[model samples]
Target: MEGIAIKLNKNISLSLLALIFFLIGLFSIYTEVFSGIDRMILDYKFRHLQQEDSNKKIVLVSIDEKSLSYFNSNGMYWPWPREFYQIVTDYFHESGAELIVYDILFDTPDFDRRNLSGTMSDRRFLQSLKRSNNAILAFKSTENEDPAVDLSMNNEPLIEHYNIKNDPPYKEPHLLTSKPLDKFAKAATGLGNTVMSPDEDGLIRSIHLFDSLAYKGFVPTLSMAAFLELQPDTVSLEWTSSGLRIGDQNIPLQDNGDYLINWYEKGGVRNGTFPYYSFQAIVKSAIQKMRNPDAEVSVPPSVLEDKIIIVGASAAGLGDIKSTPISSLEPFPGMEIQATILNNLIGNNFITQPPTWIAILILLLISIGIPFVIAYSRPGKGAAAIISILFAIIGIGLALFTYERIWFSTGLYLIMATIAYSGSAAYKYFAEEKQKKEIRSAFGQYVQPEFVEQLIAQPNLLKLGGQKKRLTVLFSDIAGFTSISEEKAPEELVSFLNEYLGTMTDIIFKHSGTVDKYIGDAVMAFWGAPIDQDNHAELACRSTLKMMQKVKELAPQDTNIHSRFGIATGDMIVGNIGSYNRFNYTVLGDTVNLAARLEAANKKFGSNTMIAEKTYEDVKDVFYGRQLDFLVVKGKTKPVRVYELMGEKSDPDTEELEKIISTYQKGLDFYLNREWDKAMNRFQEVLSLKPEDGPSETYIERCKKFKEEPPPKDWDGVFHLKTK
Candidate 1:
């Protein structure tokens, strides 16, 4: 229940966060278009340059890929009412009385696009778009639309899209934006079209079809080069109104009243001549070093010298941005509609539109076909959406950039994909968190509290395997336990031993020791690995000392037994050492055997605890100890110097034992010299001070034997015990 509750809470929190992002995505759609219009129309001066000596003559000015970088991390923001606007447009207007067709929108008038305050009016910019005999300005038809106008434009059909590799079939790409046909009509005596072309992920992907206007019963876009380039050579025709004559070419309106375009193919690896001018640099050049507000300048009469100029933003952040055909770097101002119109007029080239069947096929395949693929794709692969969106956007952009009129869509499919991916990810996150909570709660109580945590953090460690390590093993027995058991009733004896063993075990565990087993009245434990400790020797000694004090206290209460402890230190295999069906975390080595041997030795010495030389060597400096013997513990060949731990640094003052220790050393030296009678005399002296001496009794008996027949002449004082 607790795990479930935790999982539920986490899922609820993540769901709320996902909902917030979803709403933000909806809101973003509306705001994105406003930001985009600025990018579309920055240079309205140098556009519509196909018609010479006409009131509609204009030049083409590009905001270009470079100008878009103004919105980069280090860009100068809120572009002021700089010389860019004043010089380019003002010069053109001053030169002659021509119509100013603005591809730029003046929706929100601000002095500089960067700063909100302390700037001048862009009314000067807007008024320029509105002036002259043939001036036309563009705006959207989405006055009553939602934040973003998700207009679906009627498309020209797709042509061939295939490859040799076993690739997926083609689909119709979505439209970027609906062109405001009504607004276009109001803006120009000769209309310029406006479109918002979106890529697969709702990014602007490209400039739309240019030759679209030549189809029957259709009007041309605002961007045709012929419109600006040909005055003598180009003809202007009104539907059902007038016959047209352009240069040496004469055109008559068809019965359906649409003009056909004569297009020339420009093959791969080369480009048709499209002259580019930087809007920022040109505006700077126009205003630099000019003294007079109205200075007269003359230019040689040429195709674009007297033409109308259109300006627009081409920067990605400026919002007119589109993933382009040539690269993902394509962009054009809203004013480029005017430029495209001029380009078409000059070249007499136009795009061909496919029939309704083709449109239906493209739309059906893209919307239905792509979604089916996306829906059926394995949930594990997130890049399916990315690759789908990229291939579609880049494919369509390259097609348009290459002048292949394939009905392409990128933006709409991306919206559907975002919903799919984000929703799936959020759901999975909640599910996985729940699984973790379940595992945590399941084994929590069955294992040691920390063990469960370790298992959860690293599940692989629970496998049945372990490594060898150096360790200190201890064995302890209750001194005189059999006599106490015989004296007491069964209930009393069992209760007494339980209380005694329980206390000792607590101390061992408290000191980071692992309890190995219990033998009737004995305990086996070890320290230093089940997670290694650099101070296993120290910890073993410390646990041993604590056990002695605790068991001594146990003795007075129980009156049944006193504890005998033995400790030894050496390398051991420390881990789960048991069968596949049953297991125990334990330590085993020669050190363990010796520790048990030392416990039995404790009985011989009449001491509570005895440590082998291996253990004493590790901890001698920290405790008050005496060399008890130089005897080989059972199961060992070499006689080892063992010690009896008198007390630790914290044990209450041991001045008396300090004196006994000094006397014992003297007595021990005398006994080792083969003078049995002399050794007996010194042992008898130690007994005089402490009557119940245990080690001295053994020395006295050995002396008595030596007095009768003496030890071997080469006896080395070290007693080598042959068994463990």
Candidate 2:
């Protein structure tokens, strides 16, 4: 039986290990073939963990549909004059706005300039830009292309102070800026590129922070240019191994220096995710506030005060909109992306993936641990465990995202764990089924079918080595069976014994106890092995009491056959024992011997049940019993307290039984203290409570004998049993 179980376990273990490797290989394939799903997982995580934003320090002065309609109704054309933007600029400047960033690029001069000559509409916008202390203009860049306009001295402030090593090349090609019109560019405080590149999935998740030029060095993007203008003096840029650092904040980057933009808030042009004001409204407010300095302006001066303004086209045809992880269905305006980027940088909020080695370690750990958990747990329990691990990984991912601003491929690792658990559990089911068949075949005759099933479920129980464990062992025997067997026919005796053993075996199996063996009209069993039962002592006592009840129902009325039981709880070596060819699962050591001795001792007191001190301690509160005596049973040197287990705490007549126990305890105490006369009287008192009480009657006899022959001075309370 032991060998078969060991061999089966080895097979299951090998199968589980193979499944682990298969899961890892599957994960590799998943990442390579289904990479988009990974992004989908990231998007889900981002949206799920998003929090509401209440502050609006940065605002957008947008040329939205409302502004377009308002302007066109007042006779302004679709390409509203640059002079209108100049008025918006003057409004923001006078309203105490900190900085203005143009998301719209002015790559060429205004087309209607030929008709309106002396001081062109473009020149008016240029003059307005020159007067502002914090106005930044936008430009564009493309691959292998140079600027259409001339480079000016004004863009020098936009150049980075430190140089970065473009190692292993960047993901995107390096291109120089196509500067805005020379006159307008020179008039602005700073120049930044307003170029955007979408991900392969057509979602704008990252942006190029610096455009590496062929000879003119690096230029900032429009958002970054605005940031530089905010901290022109205190901020110093430096190159680092991971990315570049502006002051103490590190800008994590892809190899090509494109930054993964952290969308600090959700996107909606009118959702107040960021403050929004119509471009036409700001221009009108500037005129209103200037005309009547004390007038109550709808676009209040306090609203734009100290705010960094982003100027962008939000009209359907004018603005460039891109899909994002959060706004996957409704496109996100390009200017909102810039505003989010600037918001992220100004607050030093960034997200990065863990190092490759850390990610691989997490993957390996989850994959390896999952299969082992599934292998050891029961089917339903295994599924629950795997699900718990799945959520734990996701929780860790969310914590990383929330507190550390880090993102990991938690979804992929979770897939690896799930695949490992499911595959290994499926294989384990078949493997255990084979083990169960072999167990039923090999040990069916030796043990009950229920025990055999348990052994199969936990195959480790069938190992050949013994483990010292605390168990409750019981020994039961029919009293005076020798005389009955001699008088009865051989066939009749065998039938009676089988009937008795079978009924007892059923009772034991019903309570989840393992039946060890039968010693001819005697039965032995134990609890707390094959499966760990913390309440082993209580279970053993309960089973013994039930077995006592069951025997009466099975025995004939004419027969005087009755069973005696002894239960002891202590450390014993329990396991399969025998040669490799044939083995029996049983227990050994002093605890077992004491239990057998206890069974035979029952005959001396005419009692049906006896239990050792260790068992009593475990069940004192729940089982009704009294300490019977301190006895040195055969073979042992130390004295042990023994008691009779009457019934469970729920037994009827409990109050009366308790009163009888109290009187009996006093008798035993007096007997122990060598007060023979007092002990005799107390025992007599116990008999009055319940006539023919076995323990009290036995104690009365001992007290009378002690009175006649007083014990020697060296005599301890322990009664040494000379016979077993």
Candidate 3:
């Protein structure tokens, strides 16, 4: 998880971020069982319509080129000859046809409009009308609400010859009437409306099956046509939570009665749903079928065989495009489209809703699995491929389920997971990369190159917040730097100090310690963070000894370079420290203060190196050092022992070590016993052996003081410093 966090910070992106939030939101969802199942009601309805059209077909007496040329030069559109209707009906009657349907509306009679009141051509429709008892005629709406008079061919009649004295509105089912063709509609097979749903762009979207039943219980228009034709041996119904169902088929109905005729593209019905060969060609085909009963004809029998065919133009100018699931184009008439829908449903090309538990399970699988894929995937091409693979798995799964009568949340899963993985990866990558840059930029300037790498490798060493760490602190000051500065002008002094301090700091960093701070000629430093160093004490002590030697080497080379070095070891807060607005990567504690005291204490002796008791304890086995007297430095309660680390203190002959130990112990014993004379003698001997020893010299002065006063009986060897 940590590694992933680092990676995400480095590689975060906007798309991925959106995906992450999206997935989070998705996961939070408590999906309900069968939540989206209501939509399947629509699926059942379309299938029901298709089933209705399965046994119906259309017969056209197309007014083709041959018929139109003979009738008039105008060739179609307006004034269809009354006698032409006679020939078409006569042809269907001569053959063994079940029903004859007129796709054309005889709304405004051409003869009547033309004032041909006694025309011979107009009188022929009377014979055709009487002979064709199984004929269905079409009527179009004129958007007129007035029901005053009836208009017929050319000019004369305003009366109903079909005797509508006791007939209902649907008997002739005029668009103006509200009621279905009750007793009158029963005289014909079925009545259908030409209404279509519109697309988003205002083109007709669907053909809403408007069945002219005495009541709406007759089901949809196409379904009514099928029921009228088949008149199934037994009608049965099944019920679902959605609504009533006829057998296995469900008819979708909205609260206000809609077929859910969502539009598909117009070309969707080229498989036998195109317009029949005009009104003229149909007459010729019928004549041929009549003249040669035993011969194969140009017209296929299935063309008119049990197929509920609604003849309506779905073309652009005819205004039949509708919005649908497949696209936003104008769809076919609601009746024809319903026919197609029913067929498809009856053929089992439909999807259904799964149980609620199944939906919940699917969502859980996606949410849990996708995140893991994102987390485990590597970066670059491999990550991209994994993301793609996961996407395909989800997508294919959804598609398969869809085909198998189920709706899966493919889009949601893809969008969510892609965003999540991408977001986490992008964020982790960018964050870590930024930290690395900050590490390089921050420490790179003041630290050694290798140390900079180490800091970057583990930036936790230098935390954004301060933390406590045990570090070895070192402080060094120029020996008499003020006096040395006095010998030189201020400008030369500043330049000299910069050159010297800069070089010393370089050595400090080379030993893997941070240059904590600089105070005039004194330099403070520590080890053990910004990176851990368990051997930090050893490293600091070694650095201090080297610094002292280097100072000596520089002292004579340039009188301005001699410096006193201080080394201390203990617990100290060694990370960024300060107010939020201003902080420093520095160490502070009693041990740190002791280190400063040690630097100043170097002045009491002519020596260049001074180490506190803790530091000495760490390196005494490796370095030669002399223990000094205890003193309670300022800012500390317990008196601390100090030592002068001379050089590498490997094994020495017992003779030399014992002699030094003997004299040192005797002096301490005499001093504690308050024997001023004996203590002075031992101190003088110790100083004689090690002439430049600060501890022995200081002890001698203490002995002289005790001899002069010789008063206190409870006195012990405890010294206090005025400066910390």
Candidate 1 per-residue lDDT over residues 577-686, each given as its tens digit: 66644556677777777788888887677777788787778887777777778988766787778888777766676777677777777778888887666767776776
Put down candidate 2 lDDT per residue, 1-724, tens digits, no spaces: 5657766777577556855655564657445544566667778866767744434668887888888888779877677778887888888888888998988877666757334543477888888898886888887765444444454334454454443444223434345456677777777877787777777988877777876654457777789888877774666776566776877788887545668877655676646368778887887888888899888876988998899899887777875766788885345777888888888778777778776667667766766666677777788898998889888988888888887878777767666776677777776788778878877875675455777778786777766556789999999998868878888899998998898888898888778788888899899999987678899898888888899898888777788778999999999988877776676778999999999999999877778899999899999999988877789998888899899887788887688888888888898899989998898888898889888788888988998898999899988888888899
Off by over 4 Å in 3: 1-340, 343-409, 412-441, 457-461, 556-561, 649-691, 706-713
Q: In model 2, what are the clashing residue pairs, if there are any?
A: 170-256
Worst 10-residue stretch by lDDT in candidate 3? 155-164
- Candidate 2 deviant stretches above 4 angstroms: 1-38, 52-55, 113-119, 143-171, 176-179, 214-216, 233-235, 254-258, 290-294, 328-331, 352-357, 399-406, 440-455, 458-461, 465-724
Top TM-score model: 2
The C-alpha stretches of model 1 lying farther than 4 A from their native spots are 1-334, 337-471, 483-494, 509-520, 527-539, 556-560, 573-585, 649-653
For all predicted structures, in order, the TM-scores are 0.47, 0.59, 0.56
Cα misplacement distance, residue 478 of candidate 3 (Å): 1.3
Winner by lDDT between candidate 3 and candidate 1: 3
For model 3, the local distance difference test gives 0.55
lDDT of each: 0.53, 0.78, 0.55
Better of 2 and 3 by TM-score: 2
* Descending-lDDT candidate ranking: 2, 3, 1
